[model samples]
Target: MASRILAISGGKGGTGKSTVAVNLAILLAENYDLVMADLDVEDPNDHILLGVQLQNEKPINIMLPFVRYDDCIKCGVCGEVCDTGAMLISPNGLPYVIPRLCSGCMSCYFACPTKAIVRGERTIGYTYETLVQLDGRSFRLVTGVLREGEEHTPPAVIAAKERALLTDGDFYLIDTSAGTSNSVATAMDGSKLVLAVTEPTPLGLHDLELILQLTSKMGIETWVIMNRSGLGPEDEHDRVVRNYGSRIVARIPYSKRIVESYVKGRPIVLLDPSSKEASMFRELASMVKEVME
Candidate 1:
């Protein structure tokens, strides 16, 4: 059977999206086979929060334009077709490729009439598959880590998601990066449901709307999770979610225990299953299980 994907995303940073994802995965794995894919290549920390090292690293390679200077035809077509300005024509009438600026779109490759652009390889990131055993059950964790100084993230995100999907599982939970970039969209593609985590602050409210809009357009069922609920007024947050035709499904109140558990690299669900935060995760897992059935 194909895996049912559930995406956990947040439009703004520091919204506890990963925390929700890790905890829910642990709870869900108890009843069903689950594979969690951490697609936040820019700053992936799901493995960190799960307290497991990433294993089985595989490099993600993309097409890097290698100009065959010997072919020697600089018609400026390569530079003109470059969308990211990665292709530059020097004063000497030669096309130079800026490795960092290239998005690997390969627009210049086909546009070059001289056929000087040859296909080369560049390593932008790596993907890892780790087996996380907690309690008596185990789930696979696929993580994507972008190479330092690499700006392109969509490739790495897609790579990680694909790696997770290859495994046989009943549920495929994806943890996306903060924000509504193409990278995030790539990570959330083909999800059965999306849980958008947000706080009550003004900044959180602002980005929550962006994520809701993206999910709405994708025609995915979305549920808002109010994290740190008592920090600020949620009148506007509630209004915005309702406007998007979605409702808040869970609320994780501010608590010092959650903070300490996070600091110690232990999820509240595992640290103290009897805690309020752990109960919230259990309730969320129940709702997700209903959807799965």
Candidate 2:
């Protein structure tokens, strides 16, 4: 059978999405095989949260255009079709490529009427696979890390997700970047269920609606995981979830123990299995298992 994909996402940053993901993975792995994918790309920290180092590194490269001046007929067609302005016309009427700005769409390569554009490649990021073992139980962790200066994130997100899907497992749990952008959508694709993590703040509620909008449009069943529930009033958040036809699956209360575990690179479920936070994650994992069954 194919793996059932479950995505954890939020529209705003610092919403404890990764915190929920890693803890849930530890709990769920106890019974069923799980492959946890950290598709944030820009800053994937699931491996860090699991206290594991990434292995099996692989590069994510995209198509680059190289101008061959020898066969040049500077028709300026490449520049005209370049959406990102990666193809720049020089003072002498020759086209050159700005590597950093290139999205590797290959529009410049095909638009060159003179066939002066040659194919090249550029590495935007890398993907990694790590085996995390704790108390003799393990799950495969796939992570995507973007280069510091790279702005192209969708490709890396897609690459990492693809890598995760290739691994065999009973459940594929994805932790996406914080936003409703294309990169986040790419990670959420094919998800059986999406848990949109949010806080109780006004900013959190505002962004929660945005992510719910995307998930609703995608026709995926979404559930709200209200992190830091006691920080502020969540009456508005409750109404917003009802408006979107989704329900709150779990509410993780703010606690100093959770913070300490996170700071120490240990999941609360493992650091303090008897804690309330750990129990919440265990219950969440049970819900996921029921869905998979």
Computed on alpha carbons, the lDDT of every model, listed in order, comes to: 0.92, 0.91
Off by over 4 Å in 1: 1-3
RMSD of each: 1.1, 1.2
| TM-score, model 1 to reference | 0.98
lDDT of 1 by residue, 1-293 (tens): 35488999996769999999999999989988999999999899999998998899999999999999988587889999898989999999999999999989999999988788999999999999999997776999999999999999998988888899998888899999998999999988899999999999988999999999999999999999999999999999999999999999998999898898889998899999999899999999999999877
- For all predicted structures, in order, the TM-scores are 0.98, 0.97
Error of 1 at 43 (Å): 0.7
Tens-place lDDT per residue, model 2, 1-293, is 25588999985769999999999888888987889999999888999888898999999999988988998888888889988888898878899899999999998888788788899999999999999998777999999999999989998998999999999888899999998999999899899999999999999999999999999999999999999989999999999999999999998999899999999999999999999889889889999889877
Per-residue lDDT value at 218 in model 1: 93
Candidate 2 error regions (>4 Å): none
Q: After superposition, how far is residue 248 of candidate 1 from its true place, in Å?
A: 0.5
For residue 29, what is the lDDT in candidate 1? 93
